[model samples]
Target: MHKPRILVVDDEPQIHRFLGPALNAAGYEPVRADSGREALAEIARKPPEAVVLDLGLPDLDGQEVLKRARDFYEGPVVILSARDREIEKIEALDAGADDYVEKPFRVGELLARLRVVMRRQQRQQEEPPPVVHAGDLVIDLPRRLVTRAGEALRLSPKEYDLLAKLAEADGKVLTHKELLVSIWGPAHAHDMQYLRVFIGQLRQKIEADPAAPKLILTQPGIGYRFMADEALRPSGA
Candidate 1:
């Protein structure tokens, strides 16, 4: 069995020393990159299952590395940085980092986070289930039908499309720009108003109480995520 590869990008020798053994013990093949340039090169050469990146690098900012990597790399990136400010966290997350961990962190916590992201990635790669169940709602992907409490709910074309997109994400946060670009095309990439309006309409139709939605949770300044518990069936089931 081949262990999943993990790329560690940090300039500190001590970090490499610390994480190398921990990752190996956790069943991951740890690959090291001491600089942003090397990190990018390694990623292009062969992308890892996930990347543990540090924001403070000798040549390039870790955030910049994340932005550039997002151009082509779709793997999970967890920022292991010393920057603990709320703004820094938001910036890194919005820049495409999956999760953030401040420095002086526990190895156990990092391993848990890695497991969550890798599992999420695996789910995303699998063929979407034919039907998804969330609370009292049921989404029939093959029929594009949605029902609440066994009653069919009418949704506009765009609204259904948006809902389908969120459901297909498998609980991942879909950034506002990502949603816009994917749903409305590049010309509407900056149309935040359109997204808000549609989201509101979707909630009204789907949520038992649209005012305080539970199914579609907002990520505030980042994007939206589907938080309702989902029951997914196997592809061939």
Candidate 2:
């Protein structure tokens, strides 16, 4: 299977070293560009699914690179810079950045953000299914029904909602804050313990072996994602 390609544009060798394996583990093929000119060249050669860009470049400013890429490339660009000033973020967003994360970012969080931005772009181009089937697990969104190997599973309202949300995410990581706000509302946005309990409950019901779950994957401190990949589906499914 061809993993989604992500362009990592940064002058720092350390950044490239850190992100390359992380991107690969998160199901992305990392393409490297150490300078602004090289980054532009790579994009022109073959635009990637998304880009992780740094503001400081040896050849040209990162903003200038973004502006130039925006002229023709429509892929999402995420600013991954050391610049933490509010004005820098505003300028980057105004210049067409899909998202921004500062240096010393958590790898899990950065991966989650990348998934979110890329998923947003994908949603703009396609419609999601109301039904999700991963192996023996089937989720019927409209009917709010879930089953394992054709046996109907009983789930609480919150469990069903959480499963539905993750299934709809299509393998993208749904950040803890995003999931909490959507399900438990803003009032319970910081309730990580509460979320973990529910996740544990859901896993027990859905996973063949709850201790070694395969259906619903965890992103450590970030959140959860359903393991729904095209490669895992039946042929022509």
Candidate 3:
């Protein structure tokens, strides 16, 4: 089997230095691009299985890089940036990134996220089951429908997609970018505001208490998780 190819786009040499060995050790072929222009060139020449993009590219804004990347690359694009502001993170995710890593991140965590992306991609290539469930919420993939507590719940196209994706992972946490790409297409992956609004709407329709949700749970400053019904047991029995 061919090793998974990864394109690492960043203006900083340090990032390449830090990530190259890690990726190589993890059995992936790493291709480096020092600027957004170079990144585009690399992508046009040959698209990789995944892209690790930096938001602080010299030639163009990382978000613009993301936009251009979508024209050619269909795989996951994870943003690696120094920006820690919530708004900036939200913007990048909405712009099309599949995940975000703040600067000074742990290599182990980054690799783990990469693995998650790879696994999700692989799952997409295989035959998928018709229905997905989490607690009282059940999604019928063939019918494009959702039901909670034995009652049908109307969900918008995007909302349904989001819920289905989350249900597929069960108790796993999904970053904003991951949800955006899975549901809204790569071009809108960085549009976190849109996700927030839709999630709120979804909660109103599905959750018993949107304020203190029981199913769709938030991981502040990280992402969201769809808690498995079995995992919500009372503390200490």
- TM-score winner among the candidates? 1
- Which stretches in model 1 have alpha-carbon errors above 4 Å? 12-26, 44-46, 67-74, 79-113, 208-212, 228-237
Q: Name the weakest run of 10 consecutive residues (lDDT summed) in model 3.
A: 228-237
TM for candidate 2 is 0.58
lDDT of 1 by residue, 96-132 (tens): 7876666788788788768867877887788757777
Which number leads on lDDT? 1
Off by over 4 Å in 3: 133-140, 143-162, 168-215, 219-237
Clashing pairs in 1: none
lDDT of 1: 0.83
**Model 1 TM-score on a 0 to 1 scale:** 0.71
TM-score of structure candidate 3 = 0.66
Candidate structures ordered by TM-score, highest first: 1, 3, 2
Taking the tens digit of each residue's C-alpha lDDT, what string does model 2 give over 186-229?
Answer: 99988998889999999999988999888887744446668754
- Number of clashing residue pairs, candidate 1: 0
Ranking by lDDT: 1, 2, 3
Give the clash count for model 2.
0
How close to the true structure is residue 44 of candidate 1, measured as C-alpha lDDT?
99
